[model samples]
Target: MFDVEFVVDIINKSGSSVEVKLDDQAKKFSQIGLDSLDMFNVFIELQDATGKEFSDDIVENLVSISTIVEFLNS
Candidate 1:
């Protein structure tokens, strides 16, 4: 299950120690020190984990941890 905690763990383990909670819906990725390249890697990892391919539009709108989880759920 690719939930917020899972995502946060992945992000933190990936070298950025970003702390995220369930209510961080309005927070942007950059505010947590997540750069473009870092996000790109996370996107790839998420795809592999979920076995789902996200389109360019979905990737573009993934501005926050909430958005990422929403997209995964969608």
Candidate 2:
């Protein structure tokens, strides 16, 4: 199961240039200063760590940390 802290850790470990400090679980990746490339890298890192694939189609819907956590947990 995934949590906000785990998601935040993954984003930080993703090698994204932006620093990760998530106060709101509902905060979108864009609002956190992640560009498309950063998002891609973050997803890849998440897949690698969690052994879960993030399909392209559904990636658009996973805009926030809370959403990602819910998806992973589900």
Candidate 3:
């Protein structure tokens, strides 16, 4: 099962909130305050927690918590 709490914990560790606004949600990776390194760490944490490997394309497409939840569920 997808651990939503684990995802949230990773995100929070980056000093960002899950309650992002809709407009902010549509922003690109660079504008979202999460650098490439942050993403790499998140991916590592996710893989460790979920035992699932996420590709670069999939990581790029994950815009929101709900989307992540769906990804994990799928």
Candidate 4:
């Protein structure tokens, strides 16, 4: 299951918040306040937590927390 709390915790640990709902808007990497380094960190954390590798294409196209949840769930 894709728990929101788990995701939020990761975001918080990355020194950010998932409080903003990206559900309505198209979420881009830059829009989420994740720079290239942050993006790498996030990917690393996600992989560590879920044992799933997020591809560069997905990283570039991410648009929301929901999208991330979907990716992790997959």
Local distance difference test values of all predictions, in order = 0.74, 0.88, 0.65, 0.65
Order the numbered candidates by TM-score, best leading.
2, 1, 4, 3
Regions of model 3 farther than 4 Å from truth: 13-32
Per-residue lDDT over 1-74 for candidate 3, one digit per residue giving the tens place of the 0 to 100 score: 65556566666565442333434434554566667776676667778777888997898777655567679899
Clashes of 4: 1
TM-score of each: 0.76, 0.92, 0.61, 0.66
Per-residue CA lDDT of model 1 for 43-69, tens digit only, reads: 777777778897888789989888877
Model 3, position 42, has a per-residue lDDT of: 66
TM-score of 4: 0.66
Model 2 C-alpha RMSD vs. true structure (Å) is 1.0
State which candidate, 1 or 2, has the greater lDDT.
2
TM-score of 3: 0.61
Which candidate number would show the highest TM-score if scored against the true structure?
2
Instruction: Report clash pairs, candidate 1.
Output: none
How many clashes in each structure? 0, 0, 0, 1
Q: Would you give me the overall lDDT of model 3?
A: 0.65
lDDT of 2 by residue, 1-74 (tens): 67899999999888897878768578887888889999999999999999998998879899988999999999
lDDT of 4 by residue, 12-54 (tens): 5764433334242346656766567766776788778888867
